[model samples]
Target: MIQPDLVELVALRGAAHDIALHARKPVLARLQGAHRSAQRGRGLEFEEVRLYTPGDDARNIDWRVTARRGQAHTKLFREERERPVWIVADLHVGLYFGSRLQLKSALLLRAAAILAWVATMDGDRLGAVISDANNQVSIFPPRSREAGVLPVLEGLVQAQPKQPGEESFNNLNKLLTTLKPLLQPGSLVLVLSDFSALDDNSETLLANISLHNDIRLIGLVDPLEYTGLPDGSYRAGLPGRLWWLDGNRTRRLWQEKWAARKKYVDDMANRLNLPVIRLDTANPVTEALPQLLREPSWQI
Candidate 1:
């Protein structure tokens, strides 16, 4: 059953979505630098004249060039300032549990909210991929209009978590194969997942994705998940068949689980060459988001 508090988290993420900065690749991606280039369309300002080609448009012909060189000339151009931002969310059932105020699935909504706001704020484009058991892929090409962000949140609200039986047919590897091409050069890719090692294919897809865009991996984990609940007898099973088990006693058996999970997350981050942002399910993303967003993209 969905928790009431979790529903609130989703609503909060939807309400606050729209805090993003315009971004670009550093001018020196090849030489190594701490920033990406923010180049945009060529201004209409007059530039020096160049000889006109056979197919040159007469409208662009420089009268001064024609007069001085006795031949028509034209101006060159740069592309317009339009960047795209693509976001993928993971809501596998594994993320549905929380020992605290919220579950990992609910926390993802917060991250999505921050991303939606940022992507739409700077005249950028937006797209989304929901990596659930269904492996659904919804792509909304980048648009500058104000109406874009809502569709993204709507998609998240409607997304369903993957079930165990579903995983047998649709895994992350097959999912990423479809997702990779959706990203254009310079797009910002944000992945929100509990990131259990479900398949080797997911790793390969991530590696391939890194070749074209900047990727951020957000690890969503609950404190209780890492540290098992204190020993106590809790009813398990339906009605008359119910039985109680010692929760605290079982926790000691896997107390180091969080440490191991951290190592796995770190190892993946290292392989993908991306930064990992760890957040407790109980914590709100807004608390640390501004800092994360403001941090130089080049650093990650």
Candidate 2:
């Protein structure tokens, strides 16, 4: 398996550009055309016809439909354009663990890079919010394809896990709160994380963001996380302070906690009408991303 590095992350742009152009049309179409407004505009796509009201524009009258119905009707047009796309990546310590191909942190960065490249290729503005365990940084949406993606890739290259004495665990809620102001309606928001840092406040922020934007949560999980540890003695925890996982008791308890955590995230996502994609550390992102982009929602 290829370890994620700055070079690999940057190289994703070319692959993503290709995928966006050919394979992801279903998802891209949905993301680009999801927002529809009833307000009359100069947009070229006709949406629907409605009964003419007193304030309705006379020029928009659908003469053919009006003659058939024997009543005045006005045509509505849809706004045809691409929406902004933002990626939020969590690089907390919890994501530093993996039993397979790459660390969750590495996977997160790779995934974000691909999404950013895809967004740019689709003619959508691109932006990102990244937390490096100690600090959070954001790149405002930029229309230039390369300009929109380079900063995010640079941020991933510089990211590091929080040291023992660094600022307390990065508050995902606070990060989202700060990001709220920059989000625009109908935007596509992708959150990549292990979701070990979620809380009530984070849920609330996600709910609010989903009200006006299309939000998808991408969960990164290691095989050890989804499946319980094998029954055997193993060292766990920080360096020089490890504990033994000697029996089924510890493994079962860990599994139970993981299940609970998974349930919480799933419930919250469902309540907020958010779609979730779970990827394992063992799978290459190139294999997983196409499926995500070809989801049925995008075909609509």
lDDT by residue (tens digit), candidate 1, 1-300: 453333543355444443445444455652443223543212233545789999877888888768988877887654434456677777665665667766666677667766776666555667777765465566655665456667667666666452223233344455467678766666777777777753467767888787777778777878776777677777654345677768877676656776786787788788777877777876656776666665665232
The numbered model that scores best in TM-score is 2
List the lowest-lDDT window of 10 residues for candidate 1.
Answer: 34-43
Residue-level lDDT tens digits of model 2 in 1-300: 344667888888765744551223356555666333411222365789999999988999999999999999999986656567778877775676678988777788888888888888777778777777666665555455788788778877677453322334555666688779887776777888888778888988998887777787889999888677787888777777778886576777888899999999999988887778888889888888767767754321
TM-score, one value per model: 0.71, 0.76
| Lowest summed lDDT window (length 10), candidate 2 | 34-43
Best by lDDT: 2
Supply candidate 1's per-residue lDDT for 157.
64
